[model samples]
Target: MLDAAQEKTFQNDILDKIQSHGWLLGESNKLNKQLVLYPEDVIAFAKAT
Candidate 1:
């Protein structure tokens, strides 16, 4: 189990690696998105069948 400082450091290191990979960090507008999954698609599919 990591302490607070260690956890922060690990998170930063992971983010740095992700940025280096050139996909998630700079490619994104800013930070992680707050995504939500609505049931609309499932409901629509069920209705169709």
Candidate 2:
């Protein structure tokens, strides 16, 4: 399990990245989730979920 400080550091890093790069983090998450989804359906599913 992660310690409190490690978890806080991870969250801070994610927040910092999101603040610096407008929605790229969300997009990357969408892309990662789509790895198991159909190629043509990825975008639609990404937006829906």
**TM-score to native of every candidate shown:** 0.48, 0.42
> Tens digit of lDDT per residue, candidate 1, span 1-49?
9999999999899998987888343334432455432345446679999
Per lDDT, the best of the predicted structures is 2
Give the top-scoring candidate (TM-score).
1
Candidate 2 lDDT by residue in tens digits, 1-49? 8899999999989899888976433444435464654454566778899
Clashing pairs for predicted structure model 2, backbone only: none
> lDDT score, residue 29, model 2?
41
Cα displacement (Å) at residue 5, model 1 = 0.1
The residue pairs that clash in candidate 1, if any, are none
In candidate 1, where is summed lDDT lowest over 10 consecutive residues? 23-32
